[model samples]
Target: MSKSDNLNLPIYDNRGKPLELAYHVTYTLRLKNGYILALKPGEHIVRMPNLLATDVKRRA
Candidate 1:
């Protein structure tokens, strides 16, 4: 995916306030089945997916 398609999701604190200097930039790819795959560059790749999944479940 192109850089323009990346999502810059803000990092929030426990109080639900967005952190001023923290942000997560995800490279997104849209699948044929309409699922979006977001990839964040770095070692957090292993842990971030589960966090994202839980967040999606809550939102859904």
Candidate 2:
């Protein structure tokens, strides 16, 4: 996976990998107990941190 903001996102597994649209990343994951387990470098489906949200653009 290329190094980018997507690297920070979490995923469900580290096998097939998944993708995050906003962050433009990919990762593999497995859902467990309403939580995601396992992770891959390119994945970015996980919720971002509050601190990271600082960059989010506000709606008009």
Off by over 4 Å in 1: 1-4, 22-60
Clashes (N, CA, C under 3 Å) per candidate? 0, 11
Q: Report how far off residue 22 is in candidate 2 (Å).
A: 6.5
The TM-scores, one per candidate, come to 0.26, 0.24
Cα RMSD, model 2? 13.1
Q: What is the lDDT of residue 35 in candidate 1?
A: 31
Q: In candidate 2, which residue ranges exceed 4 Å CA deviation? A: 1-22, 41-60
| Predicted candidate 1, C-alpha RMSD | 9.4
lDDT of 1 by residue, 1-60 (tens): 646866555443223322343256544332211233343344122222333344644467
